[model samples]
Target: MKALSYLNKYLVKYKWYLIWGTVFTAISNLFGIFPAQLVRYALDLVRETLDTYHLYDGSTLQPALYSIFAFSLLLFAGGTLALALLKGFFLFLVRQTLIVMSRHIEYDLKNEIYDHYQTLPLSFYRQHNTGDLMARISEDVSKVRMYVGPSIMYGVNLIVLFILVITYMVSINARLSAYVLLPLPILSVLIYLVNNIIIRKSEEIQASLSKMSTYVQEAFSGIRVLKAFVQEQQSAARFEVESDTYRAKSLSLTKVDSLFFPIVAILVGLSNILVVYIGGQEIIAGRLTPGNITEFILYVNMLTWPVMALGWTTSQTQRAAASQARINEFLNIKTNIVSKKDINRSIQGEIDFRNVRFVYPDSGIVALHNFSMHVKAGETVAILGTTGSGKTTLANLLTRMYDVSSGEIRIDNTPIVDYNLTSLRSQMGYVPQDVFLFSETISNNVRFGRPDLPQARVEQAVRDADLYQNVIDFPEGFDTAVGERGVTLSGGQKQRLSIARAIARDPRILILDDCLSAVDTNTENIILNNLRRIMADRTSVIISHRVSSAKLADYIIMLDEGTIVEEGTQAELMARNGAFRELYEKQLQTEEV
Candidate 1:
């Protein structure tokens, strides 16, 4: 129920529809009660043996009966029509509002989560599953919609129907009404207990469902790997296990559901029996009339639905509450990295790291300790390191993906935090090791970084990346769809297109984090030569494991563990006979063999 509060803001906007819906429901119930009362009155008229009765003469029984029937029919028609119109309109309003609110909330939550993801350090993503995040955004948000739409209307209708039916019953006969209501307190207690159980079970069900979705998503995405390893049967067996767990959970819920309705029916049946026994005795003793007993029976019958609805609605409420809590947990996660309050500056990519130290949030080992580095406006600096040597971490910190735990990083002499995130990130271009492309044409993918760029400029960037020849070689050339994540393209082609996309931005600083790993040494050298010519006056940071790649840079910095162990030109480091020399000699020997 606490999760329901998220909808209060939207509900308030459409309160009028809810009010009208409730009002019409009450009117319908009122008219619905008339049919029973009409029967009772006709019975009384016959018992009185009035051949002719009028209001004034007490003698025109035929006209009276005709009038009663006609008037009851009219009320029934009108009430039915009103209830239909109200129900239709109310459901329409609720659906429309829910759709609109779902869209808005989904948009807001997705944007917030995506923005948070961008700000979070790389380690966060390393520890989390991509499929789980996708499920939260797609499947979990849908659960929130169910809670807001049908569940809410049913819940409210249950309450209104209960009050209306109970009031009518008490007005007709107080003592008889008490007998029918005696079982309610016990029923309520049982509902409360069941609600707690349902909440816990429903949460477990949702969690299992999320896990199942994750497994399916991962298996599908990595079907290539699974088949490559010939693990199809093993994968199927694992899927069977997950499916069986889900089925078992669903059966458990069905068991609870089966018991729930029967218990409610039994309670209602007991109330009906009590009403009939006591009310029949009263009539026999002449303490109550036949018409009164009939009316009491009718009211007792009407109480059954509200009771059953109470149970059903309680179950839905518990499920909705659990969903809301999960959604809130995701929505409430605070991003560790956030833009400064007074972010009003732009960046020009003169970056400096002063005595900086950083440790991954989930790990104790520091990735960078007392690290100091400076890159002038137009110099190309290359970072050479082993796989875990903090090269990528340094690149990530430059983009503010993670904040320094101590000291500071300044962009253009201003603390990186003080510059607006969008403005700062827009000024830099980053080509990651793994390139990702949308399922779009090559031209569109290249233009993604700068949508408004002129066609000529786009073509220029493609040629500059040395990808133009490859694009032209394709049957459809630039219009060929890249397929999912650029699956249609080879590794080198994807890397080249990614470079083209980055170059399209015309950024002040370009960071290539091993972006050319898939390209052969010959192709790499060609791209590096082009980069040197095109970005001669623009700052660049190239990260690489190959000594050949680092040889093209004006300065090379070698990182070990988290700190820079050697810094100089290729000639200078080789002459010094340090770690760089050892790596260079080993690579030379491997190449010779």
Candidate 2:
């Protein structure tokens, strides 16, 4: 019910279509029932004509038999045929409107989920898997579409047809109608029991499918690791376990369905039997005509398939209910990184952190503690830190990727949270260690943030990142494809492309989070020289473990266990012989520089 209410917000625009479609459905069902009523009329006509007052008794003209029977019978046949064709036309319109509405709803719901995902903090993603999320957005949402469309259409249709058929049957002979409906209470009890089991089984099947999807996604994403370790057999065995679980759950749901349909068939069959016996007795007692019995029998036969459809509708509704719950889970999550209300300030290069602290959710480990820093506009600051020393966490906090646990961060002397999220991030060009490039031409990747960037600016950023020579060497030059995640490029080439993308943004603050590590000394030097000119009038924060990179900073801060333990020029830090000096010595030895 909650899911239905949530989805209803998307349906307000389609109310007209839903209303008209329902009207057409009721009209079509009436057309379908018209022929059955004709059967009753025709049967009565034949009986009356052959009665003691008619042709067989010579009380009526023989010519009246041919005229009345031929004209009435032939006319009803053509009328019934015409009505059936008209019903088909109305059914098409009904489906075109309602089914199309469901499709639109599906499209909107999927995009809504994806947009919500984008707003959610990275922490949420850490707790969820890609494949499970994919299952919810794709398969689960599709199931809900079925509930809104065909199931509702058929369910309403059956109701209209059933009411008309049962009402007319009672008018023919109320006692026979009552008897035919006797097994109904029992069928109702069976549906209640069977529906509960089907709902439970549907939840299980969807869950198993999501888990299996997650396993398959992970296996392929890490296939290189599996082959390197010769773990193909192990991976396949694990996948087999998931597949078997999915199969078992599906068959269990099928088993519930298997029991359900037969019960419905038997109940419908019982209704036919009651009509046959009780209705036959009414004819002999002369309380009812043979036409009424025959008509009642046709009505029961017409009802059989709808009784079967009841079970199907029940199963689909239950499955759709289960799917709705899964989709709602994602839709209802409160965002952890929402932008501050009424705040949309532009950024300048100056940045400050005042006694800030941060801890990862679900992990007790503190990433930052009482961290304070101040950087003036138009200055370059280098952060040297060991692994897990809160360098990346600090950068993330500045961007409001995850808000600070305590204290505050400021940009341009204003609180960081005082700016709009999009506006705040737009001020800085951040290139992280892992560069993810889309499968597109070199020019497109470079101008990702600004699709309308002029060609000259893009080429200039490429030259600044020391990648122009490489880009031009390719046969297609700037148009060459990068493949998935830039797989076609070497590590250094990928990093240079990342730098080019950042440089193209031309923001007030530039952050390179160890982005130069993959490049060799000469290439790194050339990139740094280019960045030096770009950072001359903007604030730049360089996070690296390299002593060579740190030496060029106006000032350097070395982090140890989430605290700034050393702050000085590179020469001063080396002279003090602290952890920063030790790191510089080790890197120098490794590179033999």
Candidate 2's C-alpha runs over 4 A off are 50-64
Give per-residue lDDT, candidate 1, residue 55: 40
Estimate, for each residue in 1-593, the C-alpha lDDT of model 2 and write its tens digit: 56666778767878877888888888888888788778778888877765723535443566666677789889878988999998999999899888888888889889999898899987888789999899999999999998888787778777887898888888778899999988878987888899999888999999999999999998887777889999999999999999999999999899889887799889888988898899889989998877777878888887887778888887898899999999888888988676566477666689898999998885767998899989999888999887888888877787678888899998888887778888778778988867889999999998997899998999999999999999999999999999988978998999999989988989888888888889898888888888889988888899887767765589899998899999988788889999888988898898885
User: For model 2, where is the 10-residue window of minimal lDDT?
Assistant: 52-61
Each prediction's TM-score versus the true structure: 0.88, 0.95
Whole-model lDDT values for every prediction? 0.77, 0.85
Error of 2 at 312 (Å): 1.3
What ranges in model 1 sit over 4 Å off?
A: 13-123, 285-294, 585-593
